[model samples]
Target: MKKNILYLSLAVIIGLLGGYLLFSINADSTNEDLTDNHNHLETTENQMWTCSMHPQIMQPEPGDCPICGMDLIPAETSAEGLAFNEIKMTENAMALANIQTTIVGSVEASDEDGIISLSGKIAENEENNAVQASYFDGRIEKLNVNYEGQKVNKGQLLATIYAPSLVAAQQELITAASLKESQPALYKAVRNKLKNWKLSDKQIDAIEASGSVRDNFPVYATVSGTVTEVIAKEGDYVKQGQPILSVSNLNSVWAEFDAYEKQISQFNKGQKIKVTTNAYPNKEFDAVISFIDPVLNNNTRTVTIRTTLNNKENLFKPGMFVTGKIEGAIHTTENSLSIPASAVLWTGERSLVYIKTNPNEAVFEMREVTLGVRNGDNFTITSGLKNGDEIVTRGTFTVDAAAQLQGKKSMMNKSGGKTMTGHEGHLGIQESNTENKPNSDLFMEMNLPVAFQIAFQAALEPYFKMVDAFVASDANQVLALAKTTLEKMKAIEESHLNKMENSHLSKSIEILDAISSNSDLKNQRDQLVVLNENIVALAMNIKTPSETLYVQKCPMANSNKGAIWLSTEKEIKNPYYGDDMLTCGSVIEEIN
Candidate 1:
């Protein structure tokens, strides 16, 4: 019995030991599984990301950005405190947003200048012009100047006239001369009277020596000039003081121009003007403004600007059509930043621009800029901006739309102003593909193909978002999203009635871009709202213009009834209409 108990105890101990061994193995496997799972999580947390332009993308996990791609940079978020409206992105996001920037140096303060371009016709200077008239009633016996453009010297004989009174006067002089020695005083008085009648001393001497009555006398030129107008032909009777010819001095002529009321501010007495005439296309005449009309033409709404030009060669003639530019002082208000007028987006009240922020980021920020003056092609920024602030010299509209889609500020906000929400990620909205955009049919009732309509609809998707954002005054968001959508639509393959497809969409995209800049959107809000309404209405009304196709009206584009459609034969410069402009609405047309 003792032996049996010992064997049983040993067996129990072995069984328990075996169970313990099995349990240890299971624990090790469980630990290994847990460790593997933790390793996997760590790997996921350590994924890296980066931007296309900036390859310095690094991240602890798999996400959009490291530095500027998706606003994922911890430094960016920490640099500017996080806010609800603030959106941080990764480098990829930035690339997607097409956020572009450039480095800028400090700009020196300079005066603002404006240049006004105008067209005018060359005119004769009245002050330098003169007329030749008859001293007494007579008939022209001969003509010294047979045609126009004949030069005559001062006091030179121009024509001869015969009159009964003149004959009687000559007879009296002759009779007095016959008794010269008997009545010397009377003869001298008669001679003096002849002199008073404009008879030259030499002529009087010749008549006294001849001792005879002259039936006709020669008339002389009052001034030297070219005969511009001939009032009397040979043998034509003329009354006393009647004009025979109008003469204008060719040595010096008038460079006269008309300045409109709006351009009056540009007209100054002594402003240097470079004048050109059709007669001499290759030659240029220099002159300074000598006279400015105080009164405007009641019918033409223009003020006359006059200057004297040296036409000694007689190259310039009266009534010659001419064009000139009066380079004058640039008008400006005090304390302002002047940039190329092309840089400003005139939305109405405020001006907006896409300011270059960083070249590395290829990013620009939409800024509202207060304007003071417009000189020539430059504009003065009164407020909301500073010198050395780099702006998009070109393609600003495209950049602004990208900013809006990423929840950034844009110029087209319905609200008046915006506060910086901090650095957000780039959303690299699709670039505007204007290549295939066709002209709009806003005023036409023509039908388009189904495929074309579909393409158009696709293009409009982003526009709707853009308009919505604009109406809500979500400047940044609207710009960013709208830009992307428009860009994408522009890129899509389109159906076209003509070579261009969805051209009106491109115009709408441009409008959205202007809004995105946020410079002058407050003033332009009313106009923009009207544009938005029209776009929406048009989109809603998009249908087949004819039985076989679909169509929609782009109010900002297309021709209307009784309006000559010259687009087919010539280039159309109409600013109010086109494919890209379709979404701009009827405001352009209405105001125009």
Candidate 2:
């Protein structure tokens, strides 16, 4: 009975072992079949592969993109031969980047020479401006030109005045006329006095012949002009040399411009300006710069630049608003290539542009460029491009996206951020002039985030602390701390770094390496700048700090908000120097 029981157990064990082997084989076969099916489906599907980060790279096989070495994604082919790496963006990314696109026509430059924009205003010509004054004390009996902006011709009667002085002068002229044969010298003196009172020769002769005292006398205009002022009206009294009316010539007009401090260097006397008026669009008048005010007008904070225009048709009246372009020929450097201003992407220090090659092909590579003076809409391409090299005048941002997809070095990722191994010296990474200067201990730092701080502190704290010691003028501590810090920061974390491949932390590590290797700093003076910059970057990832003011959400102390200054912190001002909250301020003020 014992033998039978043992045999049964052995048999059951053998059967169980055989069943397990069979199940394992079947599972292995199923897995192989699934893998094969996946490969077959990938091959069967008509999917074009391209790099997500470097769109310029494309391959038929399922492999990494050559340029960036990132895994390939499907490319969206279009009829125009443009394969849009269509990104299905979340609502958040759209709002953050302010991404908007419109179907626009190809931008073309106008053939007309560049328009010179000048800020100016209407002014009366000095030669045409006149003030009408009475030669003798008189009372105005009638006014023909009674109000401002009234037009009058030369020698036109403007008013009639009844003056006692004029009546006495006329009587004296009459007496002189009667005694001319007996007292010729006295008669001549009396006639001259009447003439001095603005009595014309004909009027004087008539007054002498009539022998009656005329109380009212007509005042005639000395010159043709528009009436700018009327000092005396009908039945008003006027004193000698008192202004009766003021007039200005309307045949010509002056357009005065306020030249800003920067534009003054471009202007010169006699420069021709093409003037136009919204009142008359068809007509364009040529004007010459007649005067440039020697002193800047303190009220407007600008210098007056005057130009005269011919107004024969009287179209340009005084106080008529006008605008015009002044065309001035400027010399440029020989052999300098000019590109559309839209081509250059300005990123603070490094300005970049994309050169379009392979016009017929679906692909165009990005080439970094340097720029020179901007002449109107066209910029002079100093280096990194040749003439006739088709550049992306429009849709550059789109092309840059393709570059990033290709896993190539780009402006944002290459200059200020981490780059691939071979792209070391391609970026301008030396300490900024502000950082290089030996300055005070108090440094204005950029606010960064906590995560960035931690990562950076791990690699840079030692070097930074040593630099701080050096700043305190402790030479021995500086030397000791600097040595340890540099070593620890430089210690390669290849294994750990590999785990964080393609992460922001990985890129930040590259930035750290470059900064540590950079020998531009005389000492560790620029560590504060780096720390502040790092802090600001980290701050971007987290929610910005906020405070409550009257139940409304407001930015926290030392934060930026548009126009509204509300703070819970004391002693901290906004970037625009607005008032701080009671809660905002320095916890500990540093001694300078």
The C-alpha RMSD in Å for every predicted model, in order, reads 16.5, 19.9
Residue range with the least summed lDDT across 10 consecutive positions in model 1: 560-569
Model 1 per-residue lDDT tens digits across residues 300-390? 4567888888877777776676767665445544545667654666653456777755533444566777765444445556677765577
**Error in Å for residue 209 of model 1:** 2.1
Model 1, C-alpha of 353: deviation from truth (Å) = 19
TM-score to true structure, per model: 0.40, 0.43
Cα RMSD (Å) between model 1 and the true structure? 16.5
- Name the top TM-score candidate: 2
**Best candidate (score: lDDT):** 1
